[model samples]
Target chain A: MEEFEPKIVAFCCHYCAYSAADLAGSMRLQYPPNIRIVEMPCSGTIDHRVILDAFEKGADGVYVAGCMEGDCHFLKGNYRAKKRVNYVKKVLAEIGLESERLEFFNLSAAMGPRFAEIANEMTERIKKLGPSPLRRKGEEK
Target chain B: MIVAQQKPLEEIARLINDCQKVLLVGCAGCVTVCLAGGEKETEFLASALRIKRQLEGNPLETVTFTCTRQCDPEYLLPLDNLIGDVDAVVSLACGVGVQYIAERYPHKWVVPALDTKFAGGSLEQGVWAERCGLCGNCILHLTGGICPVIRCSKSILNGPCGGSQDGKCEIARDVDCAWQLIYDRMKALGKLERLMEIMPPKDWSTARDGGPRRAVREDVIIDA
Candidate 1:
């Protein structure tokens, strides 16, 4: 059987996570290429619909990375994002989907190695979970 | 505003289990503000239902629409054209909206996607707390703006009941005793004597005890 490669979508806050990913690249840190990063002005701007849409569009796992607690560029954007992520997790569980498929992470822009580590961690997690049940049969790449 | 929460996805999916196509109706009034139902929520629910049904091999099709306020008949007119094409309607509004849609499209099946919670206001960004009982009578003036009818666990009119302790209600420690709040407010206003006056028994007829109430303003009516 061929090894399953999961498609993971990461909504990265431009103020922190996105810049951290750039720094990781500059530092030559190695991480899984499975993660597709979609930059947002702030993690708070990523609504529940956008996250669910990623799953519907064939993402096996989704995560939002934002600034550390009490460090959101927009005052409390990360906090709001955390609350929203929890809400989506509950909704996913109610729909019979694994709540673990969605996650929220907080880190500083200077943590380039940590960003790469998260990429590898999320990728490995999704790989073990296999393709999302929502993914149509022929849609697998 | 009216607060509501969405029903579980599994329960909602079960409601329209056999339907091949369904229309999702969203309300832009109170439910929208409360985050239970709106254009975005309508789309989300439609997507979720489609995904669920597809996984089950039933493969449901959905059409989505949003009305300014479903309780008003005029706002529901847009559904007339689309109602004929769907087998069932899943309303993301409060219970009122569900019934309004059902009444507007009498022959269609209208399912409520939200459980209408209460007449309340947002406590914070994502938290809402009930504040009113909608008893069809106003008494906030006498109570220093505190509502005893709804805030009080026992709905006592005179004063705090035996259950009130340390400003909390007996029903729940977290619940603030309404009379305590009223007393504090009254004291701050130097109107403690207001509580001394004997109150009359509430008129139950003004509330839901009266069957299906209606309010009409003759001044606003123009004979057709």
Candidate 2:
């Protein structure tokens, strides 16, 4: 059997997580290639619809990465994003999806190692969870 | 504004279980300001319903529409052309909007997604508190803008009921005694003497007990 490669969507805030992702690449960090990053001015800009749309569009896992607590470029955008992510988790559970498929992570722009670790960790988590039921049957992984 | 809350997701999913196609109608009026049945909430519910149905192997097709105000006949007219295309309509508006839509489309199944809460305003972000009883009567002048009909658990017209203790109602410790609020406000404004005056028995005819009431302005009416 071919190894399952889960599709993951990561919403990265430009001031922090996005920069971290870039640093990870420059540092030659070995992370799973499954993560598809969507850059945003702030993680707070990611709405519930955008998160659900990622899952509906066949993402096995989704995570919003924002700045560390009290370290957001915008004073409280990370805090707002954290609250929204929690709300989306409840909504996902209500919709019969595993809440574990969605997550929120906080990191500083210098945390390249942490970004790679999160990418690898989320890939492994999704791999264990298997494909999303919303994914069309017999579709490629 | 009229405050309302969305029904639980489980109940909503069950309500439309047999439906294959549904029009999720949202109101841009009171429900929107209250954060219950607004455009964002409408889309959220639509996505939730679709996800639930799709997971159950019964995919649902939902079309979302937000009217300027569902309670108005003029705004609801836009739905006339689209009403026949769907099996049912899940309205995320308040009770008035739901009833208006149902009345407008007698043949279509109109299900309410929200439970009409009260005539209220936001106390803070995401927190709404009932402020008016809509009794077709105004008594705020005597109560210092604090409404006993709503804030008071027993709706006592004269003063705080016996259940009021330590400025809180007996029903719940967190609920402030409405009369206490009124008294404090009136005292601050040097209008405590007004409370000493006896108020006549309220006219009940204008209240809900009178049955459906209508407000007519003859001067504004034009015969068609």
Candidate 3:
């Protein structure tokens, strides 16, 4: 049987994570194929709904990758994104969903290797968690 | 504006349990202005619910709709098409909007996502205070524009009671005694004479005591 492939959605800040992903590609650094990146002008622009929507659309894990705290292109965009992630985590917990499914990471545009590391780390974490319980697979309410 | 707070997240989650399709409805009226039941809140709730369902193994589908004013029947008509396949509606509107939906769609299950608080406004970003008492009477002129009914701990019509000390109410340390505020303001404005005149007892007949209230303007009436 094929292993459960966790669908991870990564909301990447255009100035950092996206650039880092591009740099990783240029550097020939291979990462997990599970992560699907959605580029945004700033990580702060990624509303809580967008992350939740990714999960709703069958993503087993969601990530918001922004610039390193002081490195955010929009000054405090990454900070706002961080605050939102914390709030979403609480919301996820209240709904009985593991807060671990949503994550935020900071990396500089030049950190191609670090970007790949995150991709691998998040992928491994979700793999161990298996399919999301919300998948409507087994059991009755 | 009427300010309300979202119901406890856990309670809201339980209300939508077992539903395969849910509509998270938001209102753009008072709720939207107060940031309690607006499009953003709808998105937050829909996302949370979706994640919850996914984790529960029953992954339910959800759609979002925001109306200008859910309390009005006309505003909700547009949602007729959206409700066709949804099993339940999670209303992020005030109590009036929830009742309006329940009244219009007798067969559909309507769940309230917010706890109806009061006719108030935001004191700051996240803090809201009760401002209107809806007492069916207006006496702001006599009270120096501060409403004792809603602001005072005792709603005293006469003046500040003995419990008032150093401009704060004895009941709650943080609360500024409403009558004390009125006294200070009136004294400042040379309107202290207004306080000497006793107000006739408030006749609440026009309020909830009158069963229900209605207002009709004869000049604006149109025969349908």
Among these predictions, the greatest DockQ belongs to: 2
Model 1 regions more than 4 Å off: A1-3
Per-residue lDDT tens digits for candidate 2, residues A31-82, read 9999999999999898988888899889999999999999999899999999
**Candidate 2: tens digits of C-alpha lDDT, residues B126-216:** 9998888888899998899999887888888898778889999999999999999999999999999999997788887889989999999
After superposing candidate 3 on the true structure, give the runs of residues whose Cα lies further than 4 Å from its correct spot: A1-5, A20-31, A68-75, A107-116, A135-141, B16-22, B57-63, B84-87, B187-193
lDDT of 3: 0.88
C-alpha positional error of residue B192 in candidate 2 after TM-score superposition, expressed in Å: 1.0
Residue B205's lDDT in candidate 2: 84
List model 3 lDDT by residue over A40-90, tens digit each: 999999787777777666778999999998988889999999999998888
Residue B43, candidate 2: Cα error in Å is 1.0
User: By lDDT, highest first, what's the ranking?
Assistant: 2, 1, 3
Q: How many angstroms is residue A93 displaced in model 2 relative to the true structure, after the best TM-score fit?
A: 1.3
Candidate 3 residue pairs in clash (backbone atoms < 3 Å)? A133-B54, A133-B55, A133-B57, A134-B53, A134-B54, A134-B55, A136-B57
Interface RMSD of each: 1.6, 0.8, 1.9
Each candidate's DockQ score against the native complex?
0.57, 0.83, 0.61
- DockQ rank, highest first? 2, 3, 1
Tens digits of per-residue lDDT for model 1, A44-111: 99898888889888999999999999999998999999999998888887776788999999988999
Say what the RMSD of model 1 is. 1.9
Q: Per model, how much of the real contact set is kept?
A: 0.45, 0.72, 0.97
Residue range with the least summed lDDT across 10 consecutive positions in model 2 chain B: B76-85
